[model samples]
Target: MPGKVVCRDEWLAARKELLDKEKAAVRAAAAFKEQLRNDFPMVKLDKAYTFEDPKGKYTLAGLFQGRKQLIVYHFMLGPDDEAGCSGCSFLTDNLPSSLTHLYAADTTFVLVSRAPVAKIEQYKKRMGWDFPWYSSFGTEFNWDFNVSLDKDVKSPVVYNYKEMEKPFKGELPGLSVFYKEGNDLFHTYSTYARGLDGLLVTNQLLDLTPLGRQDVPWKRHDEYDSKDLKAN
Candidate 1:
């Protein structure tokens, strides 16, 4: 059924009433959730995980690049993947412009993947992204972070804080936060699955429009057809 159409004055009156409730709910929910996130305990990293950057190799602490805070996006680009995950690429397409703001806030953002540095670089160049990306190939970083699943394992794999009965093989997307204090580094938080919805500005903007997200599978920004782009 179609929504009822109302006169301008009537629509304004109804919208204003709903806006008041929306504001109240947003304020209360945001405040409480922020507190919970801030209050979560941090875990000190003991193992020395190394990653391959464009220049050379770097330890996990080096990823911070002198910043007190670091945000790592676990991009789903396995060793055999010809291209990065479409959803991960979609999220990354919206990240380049935010680099300056994140730096100003004393935070460094980077993407980590299990693919080789050469493969990562090729895909990054193909996508025309300048954000820092590193390859965690031959390292336990992805496994320890719960982003990569082992196919040969006989038991259930733990992901998103629960044991998944049928775990996905290969790579999965996630976001992990780390805090650096002098020489010490701590894993502050990690979010997987829909928990990463907060980072998708495109979805947020679409939610404000009439058609919303349209429930279509996202493609890499460059892969979208001209007609499909116009329709959405």
Candidate 2:
């Protein structure tokens, strides 16, 4: 039935029931998110990590600049790649608007990626993003934040390519937080893998989709499903 369609009256009746279940599920998930926030308390950062500014200068305690709370997005830009991840690119786009409220709340937002400063800055300019992006390359920041796996011994294919016995396990995207208390900085919280979930406004809206996120592995324009790893 190429052009077959269900009877109009029957379709409407079925849709109504579907919508009711969808509504309940939405409320439940939102409630679950709220509960997780309270139950899983996040702490402040105690260990300091150095950062390379977009200008190619090195600085530590360098985040949030003059703000009280420091929020760093560990963008997933694999060292082998010449660019940052597209999902991170999307979050960067949102920052222009979020900056107003975030600044007002005394919260500072920035991106921390393993890519070299030169590379990170290049992408920033190309994307027309003015938000702060720093290079955490050759730094322990990534591993400390649990965003990068330990620089473990590489596999055979890696050795055949770069010929280095040991290489970074590569970087994953995440969000880290720190709070300033007088002169000392305390680690408040850190989100890794899919911990950056707050940036997904599309999936938030898609909860209302006819089939929902689980039904369709990928969103409209995206052909990949990185959400699964994060969800796990």
Candidate 3:
């Protein structure tokens, strides 16, 4: 047998109290997000490693200039030959609304990739994206986030996909952050593996579509949708 229950308002009030006081837990989770931000593991981009773009020459740290916090999305783009990944493109589609909020809060968001600046810019134009995109090609930039991928970003042109067609490997989608303090810049967080899971807003929304993310399932993906719960 279970204990007697309280009135609805009492239950709601109790839950709200815990929800409001969860900052310590939130801060602990943020510590995981701030892993790279505090240590600043992102190395400074070298002149030799510089890339030519329609916007002109730029480096890694230069991307976060004049901003308090930098939130970078590791967009899935490889080299010139691969075009781009549709899955990542879908993720990028979910960014604008959030970008507006981040701007209101004074945070900067940009998309980083292993593709050339020219390639990235071209895709942005094609997709009509307004968010800033940068190239991490020809440097340790991609590997730093665990997505630019080793064999492709490193040097080898073969052994991954085509025997001799495509040259470089593509980057997996991810999100990273950085902070600036006067003249110093710190790499705050870099999410890979499941850290990129939060960007799956598109997948979540799709589950609400007529067919849902899974075609065979008879009902909605309640499990995934339940991730976004509020106090009853």
Candidate 4:
């Protein structure tokens, strides 16, 4: 079925009427969600999980970089994989420019992956991204956060607040937020799978188009072909 075609005036009137309801619903839902997020109880973190960066090793606390809040993108780049996941790369490609704004709001953003620092750095360079990235290569950080699965494990793996009967062998994507109060650190929130959709600017923008997302498959920003690049 095709959409109804109407004159400019009629379309304008209908759009305006829909906009009124849309605005009210959006505002109400946003306010309720904001209150729920703000009121969410935080768990105190006492584990001393260490991560490796190009410069040196840092504990979870050091990843905050003196900021009161920290946001870590759990990038799905396993140690044995040749490259990072295309979806994860797309997310990070949109992150560099937002770093300064997040910093101003007292938050530090970083990418964490199970891949070695060298592999992560190489991929970061290939993508031409300058954001901070760290490796949890030999640490329990990824497992603790439920983003990694052991290859030899026979049981189901838990992800996104549920157990998967068959899980991916390696890394998965997620986002975890933490807060620092003096010397104490707390886990404020963590989201996985579709929960990370809020960070995807491309999807958000495409939603405004007449064709919506066009059922297109996502590629890493650097991997798009000439035709796709030109179209974009």
Candidate 5:
């Protein structure tokens, strides 16, 4: 739908009003982030969880790579699936090409999946993703994190810190944050479902437009055809 036509003076007045609200929203978000950093509780991780990547195995603390903080995006690529989730791929596409800024801030970003290292390598090569990716296969990392669901692993599945209404057998997308203090590792935060909306740059940009995202289904970057490239 087209927006209402307005005189330049009227448009300016409306824009100014919206700008005030936008500034207020920004301030509110900053306050919430302050609480996340200063007030949130951290859970000490004692279990020995192992993960494998192209370079071999790594423990949860090993993922920190000498950094004080770690951000892990749980990519939904199960052992039986041939590809990763489209929604997860969408968010991965928005990740920074260089990690220099995060590294400078004593933080590292990585992706974890339930598929084997060999499978992860194949898909990572196909997607041309350079971020550190590891496989939690043969381990309870995914189950413990509440991203992967398997009746055999544990019963009465929970996600977003609540019991799932329906039985699910696959992987779900989520982001988990960890803090490393010397030899100890702590899970500081985790967000699932729509809580991850802030990570998608495209969605954030589209939200500023009148049409917003239009409930469009996301596809992998390579999967978009010529028509999609042209946006026909």
Candidate 6:
């Protein structure tokens, strides 16, 4: 149903009331984000995890790329999968192309998946994405981060800090932040589920519309049908 139509004065009064709540919500969000930066506990990483790119192999520290911090998106592309996850692709679709700002802030952003370098490169080419993507094949990095689940390898599956029944095979999406100090790397923070909503610019835009995302099914950017592309 459409919203009830009202006079300009009444509409302005209602909008102003909402504006006050929006301002309060923004302030609360800022305070929580500040807490994440300063109060979150850090875990020192001792494992010598390795990943591969189109060029060659690189260690965890190498991913920092002279930056003091690294942001890794645990892309849900398993070894047997032919393509990336729709949700992960949606998130990447909204990522900024130029990282000069992140670089200036001493942070490097990259994506990691269990797919091999060849597969990663192929899909990246198809999607026309230029972001750095690394293959975590033959590494326990996915398991360690709880993004890839295996019934045999790990008991009592846990994801997003909740216990789940052991499934034969599964891959989930998540983001992890690491801080580098000299040669030491620390796992600063990680988020999953709705914690990632803030990163999707499309959803933010839709929220301002009458339909508000509509729980729409995600499609790889290039896969949207002509009918779906048409304006409603």
Global lDDT scores for all candidate models: 0.90, 0.67, 0.64, 0.88, 0.92, 0.93
lDDT of 4 by residue, 1-232 (tens): 3368899999999999989998998999899789757777899999889899889999999999999999999999999999999989888866657588899999999999999999999998998888899999888899988899775772567889888867567778999999999999999889999998878888888977777888788898777789886653
Q: lDDT at 6 for candidate 3?
A: 89
Worst 10 residues of 5 by lDDT: 223-232
Model 1 misplacement above 4 A: 96-98
Residue-wise lDDT of candidate 1 within 28-123, one digit each (tens)?
Answer: 989978975777689998899999977999999999988999999999999999999999998887675758889999999999999999999999
Ranking by lDDT: 6, 5, 1, 4, 2, 3
lDDT (10s digit) by residue, model 2, range 1-232 = 2334689998899889989998998899899778755775655546656778746554456575777888888787756777677767665654555488888889888888888887877777777677777888877777666666645532332211233355546666677777776667767666654555567776666655555556443322233467544663
What TM-score would every model get versus the actual structure?
0.93, 0.66, 0.60, 0.92, 0.96, 0.96
Residue-wise lDDT of candidate 3 within 1-232, one digit each (tens)?
3335789999889778977667777888799668744654664422333433567767555665466777888777778545567666766766665477786676888877778887888878777777878776777766655565555345643322323354545456677777767666666566664666567686667754555666332221222355455658
Instruction: Give the Cα-based TM-score of candidate 5 against the true structure.
Output: 0.96
lDDT assessment of candidate 1: 0.90
Q: The CA-based lDDT of model 4 is what?
A: 0.88
Worst 10 residues of 4 by lDDT: 149-158
The residue-level lDDT of candidate 5 at 123 comes to 90
Model 2 weakest 10-residue run by lDDT: 153-162
Candidate 5 lDDT, 43-94, residue by residue in tens: 9999999998877889989899999999999999999998888999999999
Q: List the residue pairs that clash in candidate 1.
A: none
lDDT of 2 at 57: 55
Candidate 2 all-Cα RMSD: 8.5
Judging by TM-score, tell me the better candidate of 2 and 4.
Answer: 4
